[model samples]
Target: MSIEIIGLDHIQICVPIGEESIARHFYLDLLQFTEIEKPENLKKNGGFWCKAGTISVHIGVEKIEKSKSKRHPAFIVSDIEATRRYFEENNVTIKEEIPIPGVSRFSCFDPFLNRIEFLEYI
Candidate 1:
């Protein structure tokens, strides 16, 4: 493999069609990600973009059936407990309790049942 790879540009997670508002509520309002406008040509396809640190998170639209899975995007946070408390207060189920050495973490499902992990280094 001679190809050189650069760092991540974005990670796209899919939600059902017409659920962009729900995604907005969770990603923007709850998680505090800033929404970026989708390009004009791409607007008709639905979905939107968000800024998360140096990377972009793309919420794509597709017809989907909800299911639980371990695969998820783990976001680094400054305060794990405070983030956890926010999710708890919002009624999002905190599904895991195991802590990695030197780090604190928890997993939860977004409104679309997309598993998301939030962690912080201790």
Candidate 2:
């Protein structure tokens, strides 16, 4: 299937509130990716952008009337144990430990109670 598109372009995720610093700390500091700030007009829409390898993730926020941030994103890692240990060192809260049939992943919550899953794809 040789066409115009070769591979992935980017991935976008949404956050409930638009607190970008937290996102930077987790994505840039704790995890990975280089922080990319959102434009003034885009900031009002909530979130920022980051680049890792050839992929980009757009973290957006929403303003709901009630509680928000119930959604979570899953990340694929090379080593599950190593990543889990890192999370432990950071004192991150571990929510669930389940191995997917194909991929190995452990879901957890951040300081803001946002669910995230770290998995090993082998």
Candidate 3:
């Protein structure tokens, strides 16, 4: 039998200082992410979790000073161009528009300087 991995489970992000609080403000307050409760054992890890549609995003704080957060999250949407227009209307700087042959995608940075991609499944 072949392995049947259907879709992505979740993407975990490690933030050393535990920006779970701030993340809530941005993703929940501004972006309207639904806050989720982690397992009891994971409570001590110092992180926040959110869910949007079928996507699960978790941000956990690590205890390393040397290692910094260097990755960005790509959230899925129905329309890429419309989202870009929303960002542009809000004065968000659109970094680049990449046409990947048959995909609808755009790249930009958040106020915190995090690279973000808005993409839609073709």
lDDT, candidates in the order shown: 0.89, 0.72, 0.72
Looking at model 2, the pairs that clash are: 15-60
Summarize candidate 1's per-residue lDDT along 1-122 as a digit string, tens digits: 59878878888899999989999999999888999998999988999999977968999999988987666788889998898899899998998858689988989998888999988988
In model 2, state the lDDT of residue 37: 67
The list of candidate 1 runs beyond 4 A from truth reads 1-5
Among residues 3 or more apart in sequence or in different chains, the pairs in candidate 1 whose N, CA or C atoms overlap within 3 Å are none
TM-score of each prediction: 0.89, 0.70, 0.75
Candidate 1: 10-residue stretch with minimal lDDT: 67-76
Predicted structure with the largest lDDT when compared to the true one: 1
Between candidates 1 and 2, the one scoring higher on TM-score is 1
Task: Sort the candidates on TM-score, descending order.
Answer: 1, 3, 2
lDDT (tens digit, per residue) of candidate 3 on 23-103: 677667656779899999988877888888888888777664443234677887888788889888867777665577767
Residue lDDT tens for model 2, 1-122:
66697766666665558566787788778877887666678766767899876657787677633333657666778798898889889998666665568777787765455677778776
Each prediction's total of clashing residue pairs, residues at least 3 apart in sequence or on different chains, is 0, 1, 0
> Higher-lDDT candidate among 1 and 2?
1
RMSD, one per candidate, in order: 1.6, 3.9, 3.1
Give model 1's TM-score versus the native structure: 0.89
How many steric clashes does model 2 contain? Answer: 1
